[model samples]
Target: MKRILLAALGAISLSACAQAPGGGQAPGATASAPVAKPTVAAAQAKAGTPDARAIEAVRVLNPKVKVERVGAAPMPGFREAIVAGQVVYVSDDGRYLFLPGSGGALFDVQAQKNLSEDAMNVVRKQLLQTIPRSERIVFAPTNPKYTVSVFTDVECGYCRKLHSDIAEYNRQGIAIEYLAFPRMGIGSDDYKKMVAVWCAPDRRKALTDAKNGRGPTNASCKTSVNQQYDVGRRAGLTGTPMILTAEGVEVGGYLPPAALRQALDKLAAEQAPVATAKPGA
Candidate 1:
């Protein structure tokens, strides 16, 4: 099942272009930041099984990397693997791996979607579902129209600005579920402050105060701040105030009350199904 769409990558010379899933390059293209090419010796080092060979072949392209799965890609003559959170295609022969797209951007023109991003979001949604509500500092109305998970830092100016307007956000029926992401990494002052914020009694208030310029005091307890950090990184977090809508689109940085509401509403409308009239009508 892994080999069917049989267009060779690393070259744009092929006459019959296979509609692609994704990959790194077209043949003879220069990689300014070239990935280390996979070696046949490395391929032969693997134990029996073609699937096993394919997996190792993909891995050696970016050695020691963790991938979601190595499976049959939509492209013929290639296999797709979610390596380091993006889609890359490997040749069935265990030799070449690339991202198939024009100007280094992978896409499906017929579908009008970035096939690479679409593939990554599948795993993103799966990871989002695994997050426990208990680990988050949540602010919501009795019933809410939408919920957004935010990866935030108490120290980021934008994050602080967003938190300052928390009440107005909640009033708009936007449930703000916060997962801690201290910008300075674990063990920095900001990170310790976040751990303290998570450990504090009345965590919601503590978080709000920290964001509102109140300093963190001594506190300690078992908490999910570290785990939340890991989750945020895996979900492709590059900075604080990153928000994920229910529909899986990433809303980076801060938005004011009305602006945030507008964004959320737009996303909801986009995901909503169209109404249909009855057959006889």
Candidate 2:
């Protein structure tokens, strides 16, 4: 899952073209910026609607970038712009823009992308409701404080590390819901093994047994196992042990219970601050 997330983000970063102000002989625009300004009507339409404006702004800024769609973010006055494989953000007035960064260092572009993704988290939260709870392997508490969906693979070493500390996660008010995503796609031994575990009468025990190196007895049963795979795919997931928070935050790999708890708390506390206009009349 880590590889997939990194790869997807990388692809998006590569697709973000340099935004050059004005048309013709601008500082950054492949070879050069165009000489003409964006159409007046297009700018007005984009400005009136945050979503529409963000889309139009990207097109005007970089005609080479192929934008597929535009939508509202979790916060008001913010817009999410999707350009083919990449995603970006634009302010309501279409004045500010952000892109993802490259390399291990978090550049200006990466910081902007993080802010944008944070604002769009609600979209991911909505997807959780589409799947029924019964179909999931739930590690729920009587009075749950927090819930997280985890895409796990039986064979992954870090997954075992997470399972080993399952009690700690539970004690921290973190309820874990397991979803299958065989690192190796169907036809591999790992995939076949996970299927057997899902088919077992006692799902919890079957998973435990499989993780302990004992292959589950071959069995057949209707389950939402494949559905989980599809969900991962749609969410741009391509690997195992993908952890998703209820608030729509995604942590790609294994995290100690304490660290995970701390991260969640931080996310919960950081609400978007209201932008203030100038005080002078």
Candidate 3:
């Protein structure tokens, strides 16, 4: 799925990064034809790394693009900002914005790496790591093997169906860690109802009941519903039941129990670390 665009045109306007994360950088993974590095102001580049002014410049230029974090790009003289949850590089002076979103343009010559998709995967894994187990509404068997974090909406038909098969999933040793994602947006009825579910005294039962068409007894109390919704958005959740392997591989949609287990099995195998042969063996 890691493809180069621009001899790689046929470019779609939309940049949806999905699929297995990129492997080790490709051979000759180095910055291509060198261009002149922009002349950065001495005070700016040296002050606190990705200069505040540079971040402000990015914000000023792309007001709509949500700038999460900014730092030095793989290549010198370029500042990288995690804009709108995608990796983009801004020239040192902050005039040019380099995008890896356009397919293979992602390769960072100096780093011998793909900055776009590869960095996205890295970012995904990092963000996922920040989530503590206590924040998740988990359903697992006594003995668990694999775990997947799912963004769910109680009102979504597919979400409801997924929850209906929770037991089968548990039997297969797949733990379902649920996060609230009210697709109807924060103020709609779905959001309030889900908030109630999270606020309920018996969270596990409340989640099950809500998914099964029962209303949550209490919709009061501060809950992490809002924060979870934000996380879902950053994770590119377009719809309910957006499943992801523990490795941060996005499992597109609802897969029947068997298929889901099979998918997870393949994912686990893929993520399994290779054993280095013993010197004597």
Candidate 4:
């Protein structure tokens, strides 16, 4: 039932300012000037509105799915909505729906940005915040410069590789917070293993041991593994070793310690507030 709904919301071709594939700005191209926002008249002219029909359409698709906010989509005829924690677009008449996942992305050619990715980043950051720091298995230096949350599966090779370099990451002032994302699904052996690791008296060591093939000791206790996995799903996670920066931008999977540090530095610079002269001083 859920699969059917997701399929109905399957990705649509990038619209609005985006051009056809291979027709827009070349890779590494940057816009010379900021894109102007739509004028009041232009905004009012857009076709779609988050009307009752659009909300009803989404509810019809997934009766139990939570319909959060419904607002203007970048595309002229569609309305963007947060449904069941994922972003989806519905047409003005409420007949069509689109998802920006499974290799499909909504892009802004002129801005050199993935609009869909931007929305997902916001969702990821918000969902991640719901899981308190105490619930995550954290490995960090005494004074870390940056912290990243990783959605990992114990049996994933690259996840193990990332853990193997955990020391180097710490040395580089990068803190890692581990969240369980068992690719094998809930109640599977892998999920049970992660639960055991989370239940261990020493979660950090248990996670490391599991990653290193030492295997998690059999145990059972109150754990947030299920909650973490649900959050990962809502965050649009499709694979393990999914690394997210503090601001919720996914840097990619399995970056080496040095490369990870460089990525973090770049992100920090991008997010840092720019300085302006005070009173022409």
lDDT of each: 0.71, 0.68, 0.71, 0.79
lDDT of 1 by residue, 108-179 (tens): 423334455556577667777777898899999888888998899988999998888888888999899998
lDDT per residue (tens digit) for residues 1-281 in model 3: 22232222234545455545775567888857865434444233455444554565555543444456666677888776655555567666654555554343444333334355455666566667777788788999888888888889989999999999999999988899998899999888889889898887787888888888886734678878888888778876667888877666776679998898887777678668999999999
- Measured by lDDT, the strongest candidate is 4
lDDT of 2 by residue, 192-259 (tens): 78888888878888887787788584667777777777776665565668889876678657899988
TM-score of each: 0.62, 0.58, 0.59, 0.64
Error of 2 at 18 (Å): 24
On TM-score, the stronger of 2 and 3 is 3
The residue ranges of model 4 lying beyond 4 angstroms of the native Cα positions read 1-101
Worst 10 residues of 3 by lDDT: 1-10
Regions of candidate 2 where Cα sits further than 4 Å from its true position: 1-120, 272-281
**Error at 24, model 1, angstroms:** 21
Error of 4 at 185 (Å): 0.6
Candidate 4 residue-wise lDDT at 103: 54
> Evaluated with TM-score, which candidate comes out highest?
4
Instruction: Measure candidate 1: CA RMSD.
Output: 14.2
Give the local distance difference test score of model 3: 0.71
